[model samples]
Target: TPTQAGHATIFPTGTSPGTSSVVNFAPGQTVANSAILRPGAGGQVTVHLETPMAAGTAHFLIDVSGWISTSGYEPRGARVETIEPVRIYDSDLSGGNLTGARKVSLQIRGAVSTDGGAAVVPPLDDVVGVIVNLTGVNAYGGSRPTHISLVPDDFDPNVPAQQPTTSNLNLVPGQTRANLAIVPVGDDGRIHLFTLQGETRAVVDVTGYLVRREDDTRGGRVIPLITPFRAFDTRLSDFHAQPLGPARAEPWSFEAFVNDVKVDGEPVGKQAGLLGNFTAVDLERPITWYSPVRTHMTIYPHPGGGGEDENCGAPPNISNVNLGEAEAVPNMALLRYGSSGMGPNRLCVFNLAGYVDYLLDVYAVVLTD
Candidate 1:
């Protein structure tokens, strides 16, 4: 059940949605959040709604500082968080709304730092990517659309891309909206913020970073599956895949070891994680309707080649990625593999609530295993 009502943005493109929610309403205090883009048709996507709104409507905002894509990425790079969220820019304090195609630039390098004595600039300069939150406040919203684009000054916003939050934000005067995204940064070491129409004051904050590791032997690489496979169908034939029905919860386990391939072709099997689409379909696969309730899925590393590990010890905390009962939910998580790394060999997913069944279609796997 929802403690509050807000929406979530999984992936995004330009423009907003007709009727959608990107965040599950948040209280007045600061809350930690994050998301990865899931491309849609024409490469454009609508912000995903974690909780449906009820009688009264509330407001929200979206911030996207970085993104993930296999086409080109930072190798061995990992995402890091700031000790304290650092504000990089503030239009209200700085004064002025960005009109038309005008852009705002922020030098993010030395502005923030991690507890390790590494500043956002120096230790991150060579890093393939950095993570931050982009925020807009008291934004302008008229009869026309109000669209903002925040990308690396060097790269153009990918059009056929999905949006950061739900599309077409209808900000009423000083109303605010914020969401999250992981975009590539530019060579000049700064990000460019712009709006397609209207004017709005925006803010940027530092979170963590994705940097390349010097040692490939202990690093990770993504392995993609050409087509999705129904790895575990609760309604399948066999002892393994069992059905998790509406308003019920159960732990489903499966195997992920298929011979390994290193992008560098070295040996694999230290620890591994999965990248896949999580779905809830009836036995036949058709569109399904939903009711308001908190339905979540959690994926974790289990002993390879078996049932759930009773003494798994903390499931390699990658941070919890909250999911709703949508037809399909996509997730990417790092499984803290046990030191025996030869094969985490096993993985498990537990459905929290709601009757919908699940299907996992793996696109890639990042392994040290």
Candidate 2:
């Protein structure tokens, strides 16, 4: 039992003096979030725990879904390329609701853009995986819980793919919720989605994709950590025990080292981007007449110099997390770090409205080396 809010951070073992990944848990709430991470040369990682209350006031559990690696036959390595998020599938616009155990296939290769003429993604042969935001709307499971599952279309290409025991987004009745998922792309360049225990309208927006690197100098390769690591929690005293006020932006530097030693060969200061899970917790409701207050947060590369003017301008229309009052919403983010001269290796988080505390758990780092 937690007396107060707490958090945990996981990172490559020996990497100290850095706060890149983090997850927060509040009293009476058990939250589970996941991220990809790159391990140290020793093939191990470290977990750090903290709380505003007593030490050991919080408990944690870790799980590994799977892993990825490259074979010698491949030319160059696999790298991540992010783009403006674009909607690829929406049940409401296409046909109808997705019922229990029914799967829908969406083309990842050469599909028509859905975000009013956003650029299309590369062909299937160039892509190995895709990062998408999955949302569930108006879900009803009657007496059972409802969940959504996503997988490559080739899981069983000949017929409707079976619903896996796992789930990406779990929804409540009459409520809309969203989650992030990274699914592999099959040779057919399509993916399949299904609902379990109820029917719901589904929406998928692609944020980025993993592709075979055409050149080593362009994109960054993803390095999965041994496990998800919590690197920052606003509730912790050492991390500033305060909630982010409405319409405020904060800059965070990206620093990672192994064994308290900085290696020249590692991507340390050369990080191209990071793949982290961002959560909004303890949301302060607005004083409006709206039944459920809604807000959003956006993250972008920090323009360097660190002056007073180093704040996010209008905040792009894109959002990393769409949050509701009193709801702890978590979303995966694939954010590029600032390049040379422009706040190198840093990012800025901007809160659109309402006050909220943040938790960041890192699962992977994209290296440009």
Best by TM-score: 2
Give the per-residue lDDT of model 2 (tens digit) for 1-369: 445666666677766625543455566444445556566658776777666645556666665644556333246346677664567888878877776666788888665556556346776588777777777775355423567778875344224444465677656566666666778777788888877756788888777777775555534556665555676788999679888887888877665422122234453435667687888877785555546556778776665554444554555445667667766777778876653233456677889788789887767676665
What's every prediction's RMSD, in angstroms?
12.5, 5.9
Off by over 4 Å in 2: 1-32, 38-77, 111-113, 138-144, 154-161, 214-218, 224-242, 245-269, 287-294, 301-319, 322-327, 338-346
- Per-candidate total of colliding backbone pairs: 55, 20
How big is the positional error of residue 354 in model 1, measured in Å on the Cα after superposition? 2.0
Q: For residue 306, what is the lDDT in candidate 2?
A: 48
TM-score of model number 2: 0.69
Query: What lDDT does each candidate get?
Result: 0.44, 0.66
Instruction: Supply candidate 2's per-residue lDDT for 349.
Output: 80
Residue 73's C-alpha lDDT in candidate 1? 40
Q: Write the per-residue lDDT of candidate 1 for residues 132-206, one digit (tens) a residue.
A: 445554435531245555566543334434323332222324444443335466677776666555667665555
